[model samples]
Target: MSNMLSNGISGLNAAQVALSTVSNNIANAGTTGYSRQSVQQVESIAPSNGKYTIGSGVDVVGVQRAYSQYLTGALWSSNSSLQAATTASGLTTTLNSLLSNSGNLQSSLDTFYGGFSSVASSPGSSAARQALLGNASSLATVYNTLGQQLSQQRTQVNSQIGDAVASINTVSQQIATLNGQITVASINGTPNDLLDQRDTLVQQLTGLTGASAVTEGNGSISIYTSAGQTLVSGTQSYALSTKSNPYDPTTTDVVDSAGNDITSQLSGGSLGALINYRDTTLVAAQNQLGQSAVALADSVNQQQAQGLDLNGKQGQAIFSVGSPGVLPSSSNSSGGATVAASVTDVSQLTSSDYVLRYTGAGTGTNGWSLATTGGQSVSLTANADGSLSGAGLTFNTSGTAQVGDSYEIQPTRDAASTLAVSLTDPNGVAAAAALTATATKTNTGTGVAGAVSVTDANNANLLAGAKITFGAGNSYSITDGKGNTTSGTYAAGQPISADGWSLSLSGTPASGDSFSVAANTNGLNDSTNALALAGLADVGILNGGKTSIVQSYANLTTQIGTAGSQANADLTTQTSLYNQALGNQQSLSGVNLNEEAANLVKFQQAYQASAQVISTAQSIFSSLITAIQA
Candidate 1:
C-alpha cells in the first residue's frame, strides 16, 4: 500500500514538473530570444526480488527548448545583407539627384551654350554678346557650385566613415564584455541572456561593417569581418581606424595594427558602400564630367573658328583650351602655350586676308607700322583643309616680336563665303596688302574685259543682307532685288557687290562657298537664333550638323541616369533576398502565441493534479491513524 502511494506521488510530481515547464513557456511567450521549453518524462527505476528494475511511475528526465542552429545562422547572414542594402540605397538616391537630368550642371551647360549660339546668330547685336558673356559667367558659377557640393559630399562621407569606425569599436568592446559574461554563465550552467545580448550587438556591428559572428563552445562569440578578419576573439577586441589611403588621399580606407589597406576586402554594410561610392562611383563620375568638359571646349572652339563674325573676323576661338580656372591675359610670356586653332578646310576661313604688321617702332613706338626692322610680318593663308598656314612667322621667339608689337590678320571680305587666303610676302610687311588680285574672263577673253564689277546701290544694306554665288566653270553672279546681275568669272581676292552691299572675296573660294537662299528677313530679331541656342537642334555648329554642345549635355544626363537605375535595381534585389532570409529564420525561432496559450492550459491542469495527489495521500494517512486509535 505504501509503495502504491509512493508510486502515485511520483506520478503527481511528474505531472507537476510538466505543468511548470508549460507555464514557463507561456510566461515567456512575449520575451525576445526566449525559446519555448517542454518537460520530458521517463519511467523511474523499480526494485524486483532485491534487484533494481524500470518502474511504471513517470519521472522528469530533462527540459527541452526549441532551437535550430541553421535558422540562427541564416538570420545573422540576412541581417548583414539587409543593413548593407538599406545604406547603399539611401546614399545612391541622394547622389542620383545631385547628378540627374534636373541637376544644375546640365542646366548651366545649356544656358552657356545657348548664349554662344545666340551670339553666333546675331553677331552684330551687342545685346546678344552681353547675353553670351552673362551665360558664360553663370556657367562658371554653376560649375563652381556643383564642384563645391561634390566636395561637401566627400567631406560628409568621410565624417560618416569616421563615425561608423567609432561605432564598430564600441560594438567590439561591448561584445568582448558580453563574451566574458557568456563564458562565465556557460561554465556555471546559468541562463544565457547575456549571450543573446552579445548576438544583438553583433547584429548591430554587421550593419556598420557587414561582420559575421561565430558562437564558440563556451557560449562566447567570435566576431569577424565578412572576409574573415578577426574583429573579436574570446575576451580580446581589436580596434578599427579610419585613415586616408597613402596613394589616394581622397579615399578613406580601413586599417589595422599593421596599417594594411583593407578597403577592397570590405563588402556590404553602410561603411563599405560609403567608401565604395567615394572612391569608385563618385570619382568615376567626376572624371567623366572632366572628359566631357574638355571635349565640349575643344569642339566648340573648333567650330567657332570656322564661322565669320560681324567684324569680318573668321571664327576665332570662343573658348580657351587651358584649365577653366585661368583667365585670358595680355601678357603672352606668362600664358603658357597658346593652343593654335586648327582649320580642317580652306572653306572654314573667312574672305578677309590679313597682314601682320610691326606694331612697335624701335623700342618706344606706341603705334603699329609695316617696318620690317622692328618686327617682320607673317602672311597667313586660310587653306581648304581647315588649317591656317603662314610663312616667315615665329611665335614666342625672342627678337622676332616684342610685347605690345601687334600681329593682326585683317580679313578683307565682308562677304559670307568659305575661302582661302594666302600671304604674298612670306616675311609679312606691316599694313601691306598681303594678297594679290587675279582676274579671269569667259565672255571677252581680255585682261580687264570680264573684271568683277561692284554696284553699291544699297551699300549699307550689303552688310545687312547680301548673298553672293559662285557658279560652275569659274562663273559667278551677284544679283540685287531689282533682278540686276553682275556676271563675271570670279577672281581670287576680288571685290563684288549685290544690292549696294560691298562683298570682297579676299581668299581662294572653295566649293563649300555655295550660297544657300535666305528663308526669312527677320535679321537680328529672328527666333531661329534663340531656338538654336536652346539646344532644340544642331545649327551649323559642326560640318553636316554632326555635333553640338547640347548633345554633350544630353549624353551626360544619359550616363548619370543609367548609373542611378543600376544602383536602384541592385538595392531592390538585395533587399528582397535579405527579407526572404529573415522570414525563413522567423519560422524556426519566432514565438507563436496560440502554441503558448495551449501550453498555459496544460501546465495549469498538471499543477492541479499534483495538488490533488498530495491531498489524497494526507487523507489516507489520517484515516489509518483513526482506525489504529479505535
Candidate 2:
C-alpha cells in the first residue's frame, strides 16, 4: 500500500510539471521569437527483485524549445539581402528621377544650343545675343544645381552610414550582454527565453551589417561580418566606426576598431548598399556630368577663339571651366614634390581618378607611374617639352618628389559646379571669320569670290589677317599677315589654301587681277562662325568621338534609369524571398494558439487523472489504517 502511494505521488508530481509547461506555452503563444516548449518525460527507476521489476511513475526530464538553426540562418540572410536591395533601390530611384527630369541637363543643353542657332540666324541682334548669354547662364545654373544635388545625396548617404554604424554598435552591445547572461544561465539551467531574445537581437544586427552569428558551445553566439571581421566574441563587442576618405573628404569609410578600412568587404546590408552607391554609382555619375560640362566649355571656347567677334578682336573664351584637381596623398611622407594637373584634351577625358606615384627620379617614364582606381597602371613617357603628358592629362612636377609620395588627379569631378559663362557682353560673341576674300576692282575675271573661311583657325597668320591675289588660270598667291608670301598654281574648279584660309575660284581670271583676303570690318552680319558653332550640336565631339554633347547627357540619363530599374526589380524579388524565409522560420518554431489550446485541455485532463490517483491512494491508506484499527 505504501509503494502504491509513493508511485501515485510521483505520477501526480510529473503530471503537474507537464501541465505547468503547457500553461506557459499557452500564455506566451503570441510572443515574438517564442518557440514552443515540450516536456521530455522518462520513467523513474523501478524497485526490482531478482526475477522481475516493477516500474515507478513517470519523471519530467527536460523541457526543449522547438528551434532549427538552418531556418533561423536562412531568415537572417534573406532579411539582410532585402534590406540591401531596398536601400540601393531607393537611392537609385531618386538619382534616376533627377537625371531623367525634363527640366534638367538635357533641357539646359537644348536651350543653350538653341541660343547658338538664334545667333547663327541673326548674329547682330542685341536681343539674340542677350538671349544666348541668358541661355549660357541657364546652362551653368543647371550644371551647378545638379552637382550640388549629387553632393547632397552623398551627404545623406554619409549620415545614413553613421546612423547604421550607431545601430550596429547598440545591437552588438546588447548581444554581448545577453551572451554573458546566456552563458551563465546555461551553466545553471536552460534559459530558452533569453536565447530567443539574443537571437532576435542578432537578426537585427544582421539586417544592419550583414553579419553572421556562430553558435558557441556555451549557448553564446559570436558575430562576424561577411568579411570575417569579428564583431562580438564572448562578452566583448567590437564596434565599427566611420572615417573620412583621404581623396574625398565628403566621403567616409567604414573601419574596424583598429581603424582598418573594411568598407569594400561589406555587402548584403543597408550600410553596405549606401557605401557602395556613394563610392561607385554616385561618383561615376557626378564625374560623367562634369565630363560633359568640361567638354562643352572646351569645345565652345576653342571654336570661339577661332572667329572674330563684334568688337573686331579675336573671340575670347565664352566659358571658363575648372582645371584638373590634384590632391597629395594623406599618407605621403615629408616631401617637397607638388604636382600640378591640367586638362590637355577634354574630349578624351574619362570618368576615372588617377593616382600618380613617384618612383626613383628619371627624365622619362621611369620617374612615375599612373594608376587608375580600377587598378590599371600606365607607364608614362615625358613629352619633348619636358612635361609629362599622357592619358589625356598633363602633369607638371614641381620641386622634388619623395619616392613614396603620391597624388590623386581628378580631371573633371568639379567641372560642372565651376562652369560659367565668362562672356558678359553681346559684342564678345564670335559670329564671323576673322578674314574675308574679295576681288579687286582692277580684276578682269568673271569669277566671284566665295566667303572667306578659316581652314586652320589656330594658325598664327589667321589672327592678324591674310591676303589672296588671283593670277592667270584661276591661280592665287597668298601673302600672310607677317608679309610672308607663297604662290601656287590653281585650277578653276579646285579649292585654294592660302595663309590658313581656304577659298574656291570658279571663273576664269585674267593675268595680274587681284582678289584680296583681309580682316572683316563688318563681322556682326557675317554669321559664318555662328553657324559653325550651332553645328556643334550635331557633331560627335565628345567621348573621343563616340557621342555628341546631348547624346552624352542622354546616355547618363539612360544609365541612371537602367540602374534604378534593376535595383527595383531586385528589391521586389528579395522581398518575396525574405517573406518566404520568414514564413518558413515561423512555421517551424512559432507557437500555434489552437495547438496550444488542445495541449492545455489535454494537460488539464492529465492533471485531474493524477489528482484522482492521489485521492485513490489516500482512500486506500485510510481504509488500510481503519482495517488495522478493527
Candidate 3:
C-alpha cells in the first residue's frame, strides 16, 4: 500500500504538469513567435522487494519547445531578399513612370520640336516665332521639373537610410540584452518565451541589414552583418554609423564600429537596395537627360550662330544650360587646388561621371588619370595652357594639388535642370544663313555649290565672304574678302571650305568656272536657317553622332522601363518564396488550440485515474488496520 500510494502521488503530479503545459500552449496560441510546448515524462522505478523490481507511476522532467534551427534560418534569408526586392521595385517603377507616362519627356519633346515647323513655314510671322519660343520654354520647364523630382527622390531615400540605421541599432541592442537574459535563464530551465523574443528581434535586424545569426552552446545567438561584421556577441554588440561621402557630401556612407566604410558590403537588405538604386539607375537616368539637353542646346545654338535673325543681324545664342561641374573631394589637400570643366564637343559627350586624380606632373595623361565611375579609363590630351581635354570636355586646373588629390567631374548632370531659352525677342531667332552662294553665268559644265555651313562664327572675314574659281584638273582657287587667293585641287564630292564656311561642289566643272559667296540680303523673307533648324530633329547630335537628342531621351526611357519591369518581376518571385518559408517555419513551431484541447482532455482523465488509485490504496490500508485491531 505504501508503494501504491507513492506511485499514485507521482502519477498525479505528472498528470497535473501535463495539463498545465497544455493550458499554457492554449493561452499563447495567438502569440507571435510562440513555439508549441509539451511536458516531458518518463516511467519511474522504486526499490524492489527481494524478487522483482516494482515500477512507479510516472515522472515529469521538463517542458520542450517544438522548434527547428534550419526552418528559422531559411525564413530569415527569404525575408531579407523579399525586402530588398520590394524597395528596388518601388524606386524603379516611379522612375519609369516619370519618363514614360503622359506629360513625360517624350511627350514634351514632341510638342517642342513640332513648333520648329511653324516657325520655318513663316519665319517673319511674330505669332509663329512666339509659339516656337513658348514650346521651347515648355521643354526647358519639363527638364527642370524632372531633374528636381529625381533629386527629391534621392533626398527621401537618404532619409529612409538614416531611419533604417537607427532601427537596426535599436534592434541590435535589444537582441544583445535578450541573449544575456536567455543564457542566464537557461541555467534554471528552458527559457522558451525569452528565446522567442530574441529570435523576433533577430528577424527584424535581418530585414534591415540582411544579417545572419548563429546559436551558441550557452543558448545565446550571435548576430553578424552580411559582410561578416559582428553585430552582437553574447552581451556585447557593435554599432554601425553613417557618414557623408568624401567625393560628394550629399551622398552617405555606412561605417563599421572602427570607422571602416561598409557601404559597399551591405548588399543584401532594403537599405542596400535603396543605396544601389539611387547611385546607379537614378543617377544614370538623370545624367542621360542632361546629356540630351546639352546636345540639343549646343546643336541649335551653333546652327543659330551661323544664320541671321529677323532683323538681319548675327544670331545670338538661343539657349543656355548648366556648365560642367567640377567638385574637389572633401579629403583633398588644403593646397587650394581647383579644376574647372567645360563642354567642348557635344557629339563626343557621354552621360557618365569621371574622377580626375593627380598622379605627378605631366600636362595631359602624364599628370593625371581620368576614370569613369564604372572604372573605365579614358585617354587624355595635352593642351597648351595647363589644361587637359578628354571625353568632349576641357579641364583647366589651377593652384596646387597633392599627388593623390581628386576631383569629381560631371559634364552634364545638371544641364537639364538649368536649361532655358536665352532669347526673349522673337527677332532673335536666326532664320537665314549669313552667306549665299551663286554660280556665275559664264560657267560651263554642271558645277554647283551647296548651302554654306559655318565652321567658325568669329571669323574676321565671315560676313565679308569670298569667291571660288575652278581651273583644270578639278582645281579650285579661293579669294577672300581682301583678295588673298589660295589654290587647292578639289576632291570629288568634298566641301570647299574657306572664309569660315563650308560648301560642297557637285557635278563636273570646266576650267574658268566661278562662284561668288556673299552676305545674304534676304532679311525676314529667307527661311534657309529656319528650314535647317527644323531638320535638326532628325540629325544625330549625341553619342558620336549615332543617336539624335530625341532618340537618346527615348533610349533612356526604354532602359528604365525595362529595368523597372524586371525589378517588379523579381519582387513577385521573392514575395512568394518568403511566404512559403514563413509558412513552413510556422507549421513546425506554431501552437494549435485544437491539439491543446485534446491534450487537456487526455491529461484530465489521467489525473482522475491517479486520484482513484490513491483513494483505493488509502481504503485498503484502513481495512487492514481495522482487521488487525479486531
Candidate 4:
C-alpha cells in the first residue's frame, strides 16, 4: 500500500509539471522568438523481488523545446537577403523617380537647344540672345540641382550606415550578456526562455550585418559576420566601427573591433545594400551625369572659340566646368610628384575612375601605368613635353614621383556639381561664323557655291583666308592671302579644305573658275554659329561620337529605370523566400493553443486520479489499524 501511494504521488508530480509546461507554451505562443516547450517523461526505477518487479510510475526528466537549428538558420539567411533587396529597391525607386520627373535634365536640354534655334533665326536680336542666355542658365541650374540632390542622398546613406553600426553593437552586447547567463544555466539544463532571447538578438544582428550563429556545447552560441569575423564569442562581444577614409574624408570604412576593414566582405543585409549602392550605383550615376556635363560644356566652348561674337571679337568660354579631381594616395611618399590632369579628348572620356601609378623611372616603354579598380593595367604614352597621356587624360607631373606612388583620377565626377554658365551678357553670345564663302564674280563655271561650313572647329585656326580655283577633270587649287598657292584634286560633291576652312562645289565647274573664303567682316546678323549650336542637338558629340547629348541623357534615364525594375523584382522574390522560411520555422516550433488546452484537461484528470489513489491507501491503512486494535 505504501509503494502504491508513492507511485501515485510520483505520477501526480510528473503530470503537474507537464501541465505547467503546456500552460507556459500557450502563454508565449504569440511571442516573437518563443519556442513551444514540453516536459520529457521517464519511468522511475522500480523495486523488485527476485522473480517479480513492480512499476514505479514516472519522473520528469527535462523540458525540451521544439527547435530545429537548420530551420532557424535558414530563416535568418532569408531575412538578411530580403532586407538587402528591400533597401536597394527603395533607393532605386527614388532615383528612377528623380530621373523621370518633369522639368528634369532632358527637358532642360530641349529648352537649351530650342533657344539656340531661336537665336539662329534672329542672330542679331537682343531678345533672342537673352532667351538663349536664360535657357543656358536653366540648364546649368538643372545640373547643379541634380548634383545637390545626389549629394543629399549620399549623406542620408552615411547616416543610415552609422545607425546600422550602432544597432549591431547594441544587439551584439545583448547577445553576449545572454551568452553568460545561458552558459551558467545550461550547466544544469538549457533554459528555454534564455535561449529564445539569445536567438532573437542574434537574428537582429544578422539583419544588420548578415551575421551567422554557431552553437556551442554549453548552450551558448558564437556570432560572426558572413566573412567569419567574430562579433560575439562566449561572454565577450566585439563591436563594429566606421572610420573616415584618409584620402577621401567624405567616404568611410567599415571595420571590426580590431580595426580590420570589412567593408567589401559585408553582403546579404541592409548594410551590404547601402555600401553597394553608394559605391557602385550612386557613384556611377554621378560620374555619368558629370561626363555629360563636361562633354557638352567642352564641345560647346570649343565651337564657340572657333566663331566670332557680335562685337567682332573671338568667342569666349560659354560655360565653366570643374577640373578633374585628383586624390593622391594617403600612403604616397612626401616627395611624390604633384600631378594635374586635363581632358585631351572628350570623346575618349569615361565615367569610370582610374588609378595612375608610378612604377619606376623610365620613359618610352617603361614607368607609369593606368588601371581600373579591377587591376587591368593600361600602358602610358609620353608626349614630347614629358607629360603622359592616356584614356583621354593628360597627366602633367611637376616633380619626380616615387616608385609606388599612386593618384586616383576622377575625370568628370565634379563637372555637374560645378557646372555654370560663364557667359552672362547677351552680347557675349557668338552667333556668327568667323569665315564665309562666296562664288567669285568673274567665275564662268557651272559650279555653284553652297554655304561655307566649319567642318573642324579646331582646324579653323589654320585659316588665313584662301581662294579656290576649280579646274577641269575634278581638280581645284587654293591661293592664300599671302599669295602662296597649293593644288589638290576635287570632286563636285567633295569638300575643298584649305587653311582650316572647307567648302564644297556643287554642279560642274569649268577650268579657271574661282571661289573665295575670307574672314567675315559683315557678320553682324550672321546665324552660322547659332545654326551650328542648334545642330548640336542632333550631332553625335558624346561617347566617342556614338551618342548625342540628348541621347546620352535619355540613356541614363533608361538605365536608372531598368535598374529600378530589376531591384523591385528581386525584392519581391526575396520577400517571398523570407516568408516561406519563416512559416516553415513556425510550423516546427510554434505553439498551438488548442493542443495546450487539451493537455490541461488530461493533466487535471491524472492529478485527480492520483489523489484518489492516495485516499484509498489511507482508507485501507486506517481499517487495518482499527481491526488490529479490536
Best by TM-score: 3
For 405-455, candidate 2 gives per-residue lDDT tens digits of 888888888888899889999889998877777888887767778876666
lDDT of 4 by residue, 152-191 (tens): 7877888888888889889999999999998888889869
Q: Per-residue lDDT tens digits of candidate 3, residues 1-630? A: 888998889989999989988999999888877889889998886678899998977887789988889999998899889989999999998887776543577767777777767877887899988988888888888888888777778778888888888888889899999989998898999998898888788887878878889889888889889888898999988988888878877887888888998988887778888878888888898799899999989998988888998787878887899898888888889976788999998888999999998987755376888999778999898888868899999988888878899999988888888999998998888888888888999899698878878889878788887888988898889998998998899887888888788877788778999998988889578888887788788899987888988899889888888889999999999999999998999888988777888999999999999999999999999999999999
The predictions' CA RMSDs to the true structure, in order, are 15.9, 3.2, 2.1, 2.8
Which lDDT tens digits does candidate 1 get at residues 1-630?
465567667777877777666666667667765666666778776678566654546687676666566776666677667776676667667767776423476677667666656655554567766666566555555544444555667778888888988998899999998888777766655444565567667767887887777778777788888666788999999888877753335556788645666877887677877777776565555533443444444444443332233333323444342221111123334433332322222222222223333345342222223222124543444346433354221222124344443333222111111111221221110111111123332222322212122232213333233344565666767554445566767776565544432345454554324332222333334333233334433533322334454564466557657767777787788778877866676566555778767766776676676567667877889999999999
lDDT scores of the candidates, listed in order: 0.53, 0.83, 0.86, 0.84
Model 3 clash pairs are none
**What TM-score would candidate 4 get against the native?**
0.92
Clashes of each: 22, 0, 0, 0
Please give the range of 10 consecutive residues that has the lowest summed lDDT in model 3: 96-105
Model 2, poorest ten-residue lDDT window? 97-106
The regions of model 3 sitting more than 4 angstroms off are 100-102, 362-364, 458-460, 471-474, 482-484, 621-630
TM-score of each: 0.61, 0.90, 0.95, 0.92
Q: After superposition, how far is residue 220 of candidate 2 from its true place, in Å?
A: 3.1
Would you list the rank order by TM-score, best first? Answer: 3, 4, 2, 1
* Candidates, ranked, lDDT: 3, 4, 2, 1
lDDT of 1 at 132: 64
The better-scoring model by TM-score among 3 and 4 is 3
